[model samples]
Target: MTANAFMSISLDPPLIAISIAEKARMLGKIQASGRFAVSVLASGKDKIAWHFAGKPNPELHGLFDSLDGLPVVRGALATFSAEVRDEILAGDHTIFVGHVRALNWDSNADPLLFFKGKFGALEDTRKAPAGMLQIETELMW
Candidate 1:
């Protein structure tokens, strides 16, 4: 599923959380498998996100690669696989706390962001060393 309800819970033990609605199909899948993976989509991949959000986009089928045997978006900016460690009931959603088992990222790729019902990319406004900015963008696709 294309989840927007994810957050970092801790760094000491490398934990994260994703909120899934009680009735969501993914909830049971996570419960049964006791694991879940998150793919931080790269800029220009809104179609992939929309596809997973329940609107079928046949063009995006088979767009997954595997990490530690868990599915992740093929060109994601970052990916994380985790073991379900705890669950918290919150209103109509259950927050699944996960202990991160493995992770990989491309520091050069800009992240995809959903905001105000639209997808967008972040602006690089950091005041970094002149060559540093160019180096990061060199590998972005």
Candidate 2:
């Protein structure tokens, strides 16, 4: 039931969003709780990513630390404790959006990125392709 659940939302106001199955235990906790921590895993920590993705390990529970009454995993490249801003119903899943309230990080580490069903790290020195252009089209086109 794993999916591309991680995504960066609008940064101006510091917001993030993640999709969770309607039946997931985390859904209830997050919805009722109205908050959650976004821990950006450090490079080479695929196992840690899996644990939060529900890989099933008792020891994984201890990976997080309490900060300002929120839970965050120490050593994460970056951590943000966000308050729920919105919840949108999307078929069998719910999209939870949060506004960043607190944040901490080690600027030297690279962030773990999840794509195509696997986790990888962003290249520290790589820049975006020069002159890349973006095109926007209407949905009905």
**Model 2, range 14-96, lDDT digits (tens) per residue?**
88888889888888999888998777788887787787667866665567777668877778888888899999999999998
Q: Which pairs in model 2 have colliding backbones?
A: none
Model 1 steric clash pairs: none
**In model 2, what lDDT does residue 17 have?**
87
Q: Candidate 1: where is the Cα deviation over 4 Å?
A: 125-141
lDDT of 1 by residue, 94-128 (tens): 99999999999999999999999999999978687
Worst 10 residues of 2 by lDDT: 1-10
Error of 2 at 3 (Å): 6.9
